[model samples]
Target: MDGKKQNKKGTGVKVALIAIFMIICLGVGFIGGSLYPLFQTSIFTKDSLITDQLLSKANVISQYIKSFYLEDIDQEEIESYTYRGMVAGLGDPYSAYYTKDEYEKMMESLEGSYCGIGVLCQKDEETGDVIVLNPFKKGSAYEAGIRAGDRITKIEGESVKDQDLNSIVAQIKGEEGTKVTLTVYQQSTEKEKEFIVERRETENETVTYELLSDKIGYIQVSEFDEVTANQFEEAVNELEEQGMEGLIIDLRNNGGGVVTTAQKMLDRLLPKCLLAYTEDKNGTREEYWAEDDEKFTKPLVLLVNGQSASASELFSGAVRDYEIGTIVGTTTFGKGIVQSIYPLKDGSALKLTVAKYYTPNGVCIHGKGIEPDVEVELPKAFRNSLDVPKEKDTQLQKGIEILKEKMQK
Candidate 1:
């Protein structure tokens, strides 16, 4: 009877242990099954939640505006504004988004060929009125009685008052064979006159050269564009043929244009040295060097002023750093940032500031202009006088004087 009781007690203990083990396994399986669906959902959805949230909010706002706006709105313009506003929010003055038309017009301008009534216009600093710098002598504007010193009042009968100069200029540019009407007030006549000028393809006048004196050549580079380097070479070669012993490069008031054109010009002037280098946001440096062995060895003088900028600063800075030429005038305009244009798929573009450039000696002229070796300021009274004699243009006279001195050396 004692053995039988012991065996029954031991068997009961073993059965209790097995029951607890089965309960534990069931509990674990139940919990895992409950969470597996949730885990799968989170894995697939969490990564895109933020993107979905933003797009949902934008869609809601767009729908609300379209449904409750005061009047019918242009959805296309609204979409364009979104892009423009996004770029504007960056707070970079040089970063901009251009429409198809704007991009094409700008490219044409850079290419140094465009269809427009050939007249250079600028807003008068004091009057805030659009003034004609000059009508191209070979263009229809000149043939249509437009002249320098005329004030532009209207384009195509739309008053240009309170409009930006850039917009007005764009309005004047169009496809070849188009006609643009301009109403202008000529100071010579003291009356408003209208002219219907035909737009035609014309070469931009980027470089103008003349013989300042015997053996002294003067070349004025208005801006660096597609044709600038080639035009400059032609002028220099012609001057050399004329027994030119020295050269004066007038870059005064030249707001910079194409950077490559400036580089090409530097290659001709610099003697196998680093022309310039640019540093991007990634801390990568791109160095430009002069590959040409032949260079202009004659005495060279570069003229600059407060309006000289961008590529102008590059050209003058490199020349100054290399001791290749003497800069004569007031300080430059001090724009050292370089812009790169990226074209969009829809014929538009983004012109953004990509890098900051430094001179050959690693001097960054971002906010500080390159100082001239000889500082000479023109008098305010004679600043815009087209007929100002050589003796009166103090800055030009200084440049001539410096070039003559360099030639003697």
Candidate 2:
């Protein structure tokens, strides 16, 4: 079976999104249960809480690895004797202390821009289907046949059901030119079939626009990054100069980028309305205001899907609430929590959940995602994708139909 593996460079994704503190995994909820009381703040400092048992375990592990392990152990590889003991002592699978290099890698992902498969992917909680949010025309996944709403149930032989999103990403990403197999479930047939996808480099952050006959303009936003707001602004200005009327802001499969950038886009779109709101601790709140009057007041249609999350969720929530545009597609990724990266005193950092972002309607889409006015789910069979479809894309056809009606109006 042949399937295309989407390329993902471990660079620009916000690992700890503010999705209400989606942290510590669904595991290791407590540290050593009863033993944790022995190492509480009252008894021990935050650093040295390990018992002698842990130290002995670390020594045994180190000696065994050095003498009998298959791989060679480097002398400088160890952090500190205390650190080794700490890992052994924690007894919590979820809690981990990263080395400096690992810590830096962890922090670099928050900018939300990456060079890989141009599609935003998310696991459907109900079906465990891997759905694409949006697709970049130039990326390999788009070229392969991954569509905005295609659900993947199996990666090779591994069932993706209940697997974490990170695990799915790891299975899909690899060195360029490698292929991964997937059993995609199309909405038409509702039966799973296998397909192999080869990995390739995916570069994004380029907002392209085109005149779609007369005053209608098509704007494809690849991904939101540090400069997306500015880039989209320029694109809007050019389209307006060309006498743009209906604007199609394609955010399908857009896993979301920076909140500030999304806020910038909202500022450009909603104009004077309350674009977005975030709440911090103790009733503290921050509201993002529009930068100026709305740029294009024409009928706008936002394309979204299950992969639309974080910043994109914020944008869609505001648009739907303000009635600024028609949000077309399936329900969006329910990620309402906001996370702010806190730089720790040590070289490592703490990516803690900071606040909850609510849409203008005071709706929280963290666990419950946003529902589109028009619901167009893909049938479980017959090549369902926004990329190059083996059959037809009901979602795209519906969007175009809705946009056409809006244009006629």
Candidate 3:
């Protein structure tokens, strides 16, 4: 009787919790319903400052523009003021609403096809330093002495150690043949040096592969572009045919591409179950999972660095959650926000941060990158050197060590 009573009490508690949840849900629904008509009917005037407080701001901005703006200030400048105010109002350092032109640049850069230095950037959580990892060979950064592990302390004298990754990249970017002065710090030293690197357009080579000693396959994913899945699939097929045992996916300096590419890669690794889902503000959720688990049963290692961001971080984080393989490198780039790229009627597009993403284990890497199994720092002495430093391959060495141990076992 006592046990039954206890069970009844627990059941009652659960029922009460469910009731509360449903009540809250209904309340939200009611409020949303109340607002829907207001939104649809254009109840609020468009030109009348969006918010009450903004009326004062709009007037002030109007006065300022009339006094200081060059020529007769057009709607474009006014709209820019509103956009700037929106970002400033959010009070979130990580979130920025990009304009059409800015969004186009972002999308182009994400796909690794951009008119700027071809490099990847991730941040140091402890120091808040933006790290440039593994600049593409013969690329501007590579030619300018930036390497796999170099911290960008400042851009044009503005310290980026406290700035967001996207902001730093924006400040550093420009047209081809133009120069951006970067104050870079090496991992081994406190002294920083200024490097004037010229900007250039990069035709992205999204994927590359190498056979390591006929038993290991080295696959490098520079970014997650539309073609990333095809390149990866082709790589796996080719490597498997050529006798491969271990695989290493180097995502160093890879500042994320497309989320869809990440899904495809996850499908290649995980079982045919739910891998991840994202929830939106309007209470919508979409699920994704692996298509099949019978693909590769071998050992895998994902190589990340300060610059491995977005979709790359998602892949590495998911694999880590599943315990499928080891992520060996420095910390990853913590850009977990999912941006929606919308094409306008014109040739332009808008990329806005709609929602953030999480790993299978529910880790949000928005500002904190994934920790590597083995933390590796490149040698400061050789970070700016032309050739790969002998002792600076801590991440790669750790990967090789772990792979060899797994092979031995």
Q: Per-prediction TM-score, please?
A: 0.73, 0.59, 0.63
1-409, model 2: which lDDT tens digit per residue? 0000001111112122211111111111111011111112335445755567766987998888878988766664665334534544554222334445544533332223222345556445445666654555666666777665567788778898755344455456554566778777655566666777766665444477877764777787755665568889999999988988778887755666556777788888776767667776777877776777855578888877765666778888888988877877677766666543333445643333446778887787776778887776655452234453513656655666677788787
TM-score of 3: 0.63
lDDT of 3 at 101: 66
Q: Which prediction has more favorable TM-score, 1 or 2?
A: 1
Better of 2 and 3 by TM-score: 3
Q: Write the per-residue lDDT of candidate 1 for residues 203-321, one digit (tens) a residue.
A: 56778898767588989886665567999999999999998998999886565656677888888877678888888799888777788777889999888876666678889988998
| lDDT of each residue in 1-409, candidate 3, tens digit only | 0000000111000110000000000001110001111122335665654777867877987889788978876787677557666666765443444556654543343332235676655555446676554467757777777765577788888887554344455566655567889898865566788889887775445688977773888797866655578888889889988888888888765666556667787787677756655555665655556777655678888887655666777788888888878987677656665544344443333334556667777777767778888776666654333235434666666776777778777
Name the regions of candidate 3 deviating beyond 4 angstroms.
1-42, 45-49, 64-75, 92-204, 341-351, 382-392
Q: Cα RMSD to native, each candidate?
A: 26.3, 11.1, 13.8
lDDT of every model, 2 decimals: 0.66, 0.58, 0.60
